[model samples]
Target: MEEEKMEAEDPNHNNWERRPESPPELPAPPEPAAPCRRRCDSSGGRALLGISGSTSKFLMNVITVDDYRSTYWPKLESAIDQLLTQSPGDYIPISYEQIYSCVYKCVCQQHSEQMYSDLMRKIACHLERVSQDLQVSSPAHYIEKFNLALGQYMGALQSIVPLFIYMNKFYIETKLNRDLKDDLIQLFTDHVADKHIYSLMPLLIEAQSTPFQVTPSTMASIVKGLHTLRPEWVQLAPTLFSKFIPNILPPAMESELQDYAAQDIKLQQELMQNGFARGDQSRKRAGDELAYNGASSCGSSQGYR
Candidate 1:
């Protein structure tokens, strides 16, 4: 027994101890499957998905796969419904104030030049009706009441006139729809001739203040109106000249007393030109000095002097 135990304990004895069990091998990880690509319909199917052609095109050009479900896909669905709606205007869930706000926004915050033109044309048409109403009614009392209401409405919508004018001018300049431009210009001219330009002063002021890229049709009217009305400092020049400068203050009663403005813009322009020339000369002198110093650093003698 001692011998057997000694043999079992021997370092090189095969029977001394059971062979150590081989380590179990782990199974290889299953191959990752290729991701499935979603095939979206392209031929007007995207339109059915509620995406506007423009939005769809933009999405296709710029949107990524990860963002599709989150941003583009939802918008696409909404766009489809909006596009297919028979009357989106009717569907718009807004209050009366919101409607007015939208109208005002169309006038004041219009982004597209074409949209602005359309809005101005609509406003001009409304104004034409108002002018017609003013013309047909012979009673001063009725006219006064009507004028007050119309003035209030115009005042409320005043914020957008500049936008309308801008689009109108762009349309005219581009000759996009010359007939509309001619008609609108004629309408404005007639309104000025009728001496109703005063009523539009509030809107004119707001319009002039807009820094939009498009030029206001009101500018042409302003220049011509100014020449005709020769409004003093306080008085509003004809609506045509509403483009001369922003209306900082309302036409005062004092305007009725004066025939012309005291300050001559032409003279101011000349003074500005002189100042600009002086400034240019000063800058040139400074630049020359810098050049002279640079030359001096190189041990060169050349200079303006």
Candidate 2:
């Protein structure tokens, strides 16, 4: 009875005795929506999604090696011909910017090796032609022609090197560990200068020995030009003179010099004899004139007295 009365007095007595009601079941969470699928279009090769149309076209339309060669090589060849054939100081017919673009594209397309090889071959051919032309020149004119050709070729290279700067820096310098200009110069030396060096040596020696016979400027041009193409030639001239002069001079020039020296001595002695005879005659005439003047003065003074 005391427990019941206490329970009744408690405001929570019935609630404590009653079982707690279970919470109503919540509906299952809705399934997450599927991600929207973007199907890539497969026509005309695989299309790059999220890229601009121009970029996509550029990637898709890759230029094959053959295509590059076919489409651009003729243009390049023609331009090179124009560059090589143009007279010194003449305006270039081809556009430098256009060639630069083509070369840049070729290098970017990984065609540098082929392009470099073809360019070298073309240059070698041009040099070969130049060598043949130089070979046919008369010995008297050989140095002049060679100097002219060298100047023209080097001038053309000045125009060419800039056009190929991209390929030269990226492929020639980096991969081959060579300088483009040096390689081109070497080509000229090998094909043109070196081949003719032996034949040219005698003329060069003669010109140097008697510089007055040839224009000093012409001799200087040839020497400087050859030296530029082949630095070793500077030392070579002295070496050649030291080794060959003794043997060569006696056979060729020494006899001529001795003959001229004998003739010169005879002529000089004859001139000296003539001079002395003229001096003696002048002295005798001066004495005679003085004696006549003295006689004339004496006669005049006597007559006056």
Please estimate how well model 1 matches the true structure, expressed as its whole-model Cα lDDT.
0.36
Which stretches in model 2 have alpha-carbon errors above 4 Å?
1-56, 59-61, 239-305
How close is every model to the real structure, measured as TM-score?
Answer: 0.25, 0.59
Q: List the residue pairs that clash in candidate 2.
A: none
> For candidate 1, what's the RMSD?
28.6
How many Å off is the CA of 300 in candidate 2?
Answer: 66
lDDT of 1 by residue, 1-305 (tens): 43343233232423222211111222211111111001111122453456576854443333334333343233323322332232312232212222222222222222224344444555455556766666565442332434343333333232233322433443334445553334544544555324554544444455444332114443444433434333452244333243344443344344432222222233335557546332444556777877864554332111100
What are the Cα lDDT values of the candidates?
0.36, 0.62
Expressed as tens digits, the lDDT of each residue in 19-58 for candidate 2 is: 1121122221121111101111111222424556676444
Candidate with the greatest lDDT versus the true structure:
2
RMSD after CA superposition, every candidate: 28.6, 34.4
- Model 1: weakest 10-residue lDDT segment is 32-41
Per-residue lDDT value at 84 in model 1: 23
